[model samples]
Target: MSSMAERRHGISTPAASTQLKLRFIDRDEHVYFWFPLLAGLSELTFDPRQEIRHSALEVLFDILRFHGGSFAQSFWVRIFDSVLLPIFDHVRAEVTDTTTFTSEKRRQQEEQWLYETCTRCLQHLVDLFVQFYDEAFTLLSRLLDLLRGFMNRSHQSLAAVGVAAFVRLAVKAGPIMNETCWEEVIAALLAILEETAPEARDLITPPPRLNPAVAAAVATAVATAAAPISTSVSSAISSEITPASGSGSPSGGPSAHHPPTAPSGAAMANGGGGAAPVGAGGRTFTLREGVGARRLAKFRCQAATQLLLVQGCSEIYANASQSLPPGAVRGLLDALAFIHRHAHAADMDMDLRRRLAVQQ
Candidate 1:
């Protein structure tokens, strides 16, 4: 009995002692080895006993990978309910309402930890809860709301990540999803994804932003501007009119002021036609092609959003690979890639919208 009690302190065995030693953090910048936090959290998830395991789960500051054999495979509701849900509520409260605290220093400190821990735990729960999407709809829905909270408050990184995670859950939920779920979830993801990729800061801040990488990705690809009108729109209303100047009357001979014709095939410039003047030898450029275009101007106007999504997807795969086994990364990569593909489809929708505007 005495030995068991002592083991509970993480000192009875060499491995337990080492784990405890790893958790001994002083908050001193130099002595900090944050990576051990990963191992400790990993153990907490895989611990054999349910009660001790749940307790262990509480102190974790990071999520463990259950993708391969790394972490034990199991439905983690008891741990999630006993350890995660309450902690999520508390962390959420701490980061929210900066004014609730008396001092700015305290508020900022709380905000930093709150945001960090919030994200870490969120990823953990999401990774675990995903398998049980049908059974855990309520928990998943609440989590989606918590994630959206970051977006509502201008937490860009958190918001981007949260939206992406939520989208994944919704897709997995299949027919279980509803219209309200769409509003609470999918719409936000589309809105943020549409923002100018390169200027995430200009990309109208979602509720509270979340994932810095995603925001950075956004800044890398997109910008705020008019959407592309259409891929098939070869020329404007007045573009193909040729270089002939409008004549006063039919009796008048060829308009004197007009040149014979645009200098050869001077590559249609912006101001080339009769009403408008083409640039650089009466030839200007415009986008009239689809995805196949070498560099679609409509796409350029977005600041390369597709590139940003691909990068984010890559990051997701890389991060998951580090913690997960090869088998697990495949599903995660597939899901994230799906999100990336959907974002591209949304861009095409923007193209359609632009074309419709030009037509009307």
Candidate 2:
């Protein structure tokens, strides 16, 4: 009976039937119809038509709802290698048919679809990074460059959430690298953090007081992450991070970078990316002194505001533990540890927040 039902739902793909055995929805609650859905998503990435591509993205995103704590460990890498990477490479080069001079309206519409679609996928990827930071460590440099390009002036509208996505990834990625390398990422984040912070009400008001708790996380990330490989970030960035949209591609110029990822979240400052300003214009900004309070507050996770905050956010994963079918959580945890290291800075005030965190 179950086998017949699986076939009716289009869950019986070659890959799913062979490797996955049963549809994620049918076989195990731990992984809902993962076998068939995962297989279907993998195929969608290679579809030649834009419409097909869009549909595939949507389905994969829908499935991501089932991915969370455990699912991340079960299926993230399969998506990364089999689905994301391939689609990333394919979509990197936007197909331009000379005959199909897509009108401005058409182009804008397509871009909008892509933007929304990417956000969904990117968010899931963020979950993976948070769960398995180290698994996604090799992706840090790539992610940094990606954020800059996505949030830059080129794609102003799309960049809004794009910037947030970058922040989450940075928070997660920063801790996985060795000390020296980690600083590089943090330096970039500090610049971003500074930009997001309100202008200290005439620069004399102690610089937008920061949360001792959050500062600790940022401090930790800067303190850890990345190994010193004598290579320049700019150079490595060229090879590592490719914008999802063939960014900076001058209509007919160079191709943009590609590595399709999940969605990210951030708060706008009337707003913001990269590099610490030298000497802070004769001022000082260090871990000892602490970053502004507003920056710390962003990731604070208001337990109360959870309803409002998650309103627009599609309830993808029912519980924090039920999603990410397989092997994904490891990646998220590794990344979360990294982000915690840098963004939280809560460590510095752990003794204090410890009481708070414990209460929660």
Candidate 3:
């Protein structure tokens, strides 16, 4: 009984003793081993084998999570440049190079692992430092740009991982995400849904808007300008008018300027074609080519990935709605509804459709 009590009094277990030691250990102790450890791990991240790279990244992330703020900014930047940035370039190269793998299945498996590692690393970086460091916002923007590129790739695996990562970022980083970041994420997700469910594209797509008052004014001005040109052209054609001074050569009959074409009011009102010149947000919006049924089938084949994205959508709606701007919130709501409707219409499993309806 005495032995038991004595043992329990101090350093009772390995964990307890370790914690006790940690409490007394100066933060400066890490300085001795930090760079050396980072150096070793940084080398491992570039290894040709995926497993080694993944393990190295896991260690790096663990260090960041536990002691992220303890180190100098330069150390963190070294990790960012040497360890994090290289992984991005490596994964991208691996995904695009078809000759590396002997078979498609192996390629996909390798790609999937690479993508999952990339996402896990990114999540650790953003979740650990986004609030405390200003540099993190820049990282967040770079993350969005990377994910956007991933979503644009032809591989279903790439798109799936991109969407999943995007959703996670939005749900986790909602408070810190600025308006531009929010819009970019929202735009990327909608682009995915638009590709996966072409039939419902119109439902979620934002219609081109020109202020009615502006449209009316522009149309009136165009009509007033076109009338004189039309009358002049008709009279010139009827009279078979010759060149007007320097407008055309005297020997050239019925000069090109004689039948000058003026844009009609409707054409001007339509913004030159069927689309608006620019959006209200000061961005030019253009739709991609229509996604085909084969692509939809590919999306269906990756049901797990699709479900991940759907759950992410629900999470963003449930947890981040208040943090988002009004426009983004409205866009998310519309996206969620569209997903539910498409799932039901496509005869997707009842549970998925339900998940879409329930936020988070």
Candidate 4:
């Protein structure tokens, strides 16, 4: 427990602990001593007990963080191929299963822990020993797929963690992450925005049912009020009441009016105003002024803010911008425009919004 706590918080270790581990590995020039232990720990990662698996991952992460490069490239490759790859495979299978567990709550808890451990281990490995990444391209591809799967999951918490991990991986791997991976991530985030957008109708409560006698009286009152409109300019009113079409509000409910596009400050570089430019995927997602639009703008702004932060803090975006596929940079630009256009609409801290606007 104490060791686990120490590892979790990254407590500074004494020279003895670090030296002893290095000395043991150095003494075992053949790696006969460490290989079996690594295998055992890897096996423990799949243990039925969450604590055991978490503890095993903690130990492995610490080992990699402290002395990962000490081993030969081939040794690390073997660890990735034999140990990490299998764990990713298991995670994929578990995530795909549609079967209902006897104790769903417990299962969800276990799955969350598994995802957390997997993400942390992968991040640590990539951060500490990126030199071996090219050699492990196959494994890295699988890891990316696992991350995409996590992001596509219905569970928001899991998906949010997946997004963070995806960003971290991009920041760590830089040029190594290909365009296809970036597209997948961008698509997933857009889907999340669409899914989470709130409907104005959903926000508004329906009026309480009136009493039977009151309902009749209300209906009569409405009929009498409509009599004058029907008598005058009936044809004009009929022409104005066009059937609802795609240009109208979304299915969730009707809005008083379509939300306006983002402000000029949020417009895409190539676009003149707040109109949503087509993304790399050939989809145009427009921002409006209604509740749903505001909700979506909030999410889009937040996602873009995080991406921009990663870009500024690391070389990933700079490296990626040079090799970006057609429409990719535009998609990113659109996100940035949304952030700026609806800067005031988003329910975010004014300081943060100001910082984002300044970046724009």
Q: Highest TM-score among the candidates is held by which one?
A: 3
Q: 1-360, model 4: which lDDT tens digit per residue?
A: 887787788775785377555422333454676767777777787787878988887787677556565655566656666666676666656555522543677677766766676666666655654555544444555556556655555444455566666667666665565777566545544544344333322211112223455456546658788545343343443333322111222123322233423323323331223233332223342334333244445455445534443343234356456656655566556555543433334333332233233223
Instruction: TM-score winner between 3 and 4, please give it.
Output: 3
Tens-digit lDDT track of model 3 for 260-343: 133245433323333332323444323332222333444444454456567777778888877988878877877878666655
Q: Which stretches in model 4 have alpha-carbon errors above 4 Å?
A: 1-35, 70-75, 96-99, 129-142, 175-331, 334-360
lDDT of candidates 1 onward, in order: 0.42, 0.41, 0.56, 0.51
**If both were scored by lDDT, which would come out higher, candidate 3 or candidate 4?**
3
TM-score of 1: 0.30
The ten-residue window of minimal lDDT in model 1 covers: 200-209
- Measured against the true structure, the TM-scores of the candidates, in listed sequence, are 0.30, 0.34, 0.48, 0.41
- Superposed model 2: Cα runs more than 4 Å off: 1-55, 58-81, 95-100, 171-184, 187-360
Cα lDDT for residue 139, candidate 1? 61
Lowest lDDT block of 10, candidate 3: 242-251
Candidate 2 vs candidate 4: which has greater lDDT?
4
TM-score of 3: 0.48
lDDT of 1: 0.42
- Give the lDDT of residue 30 in candidate 4: 40
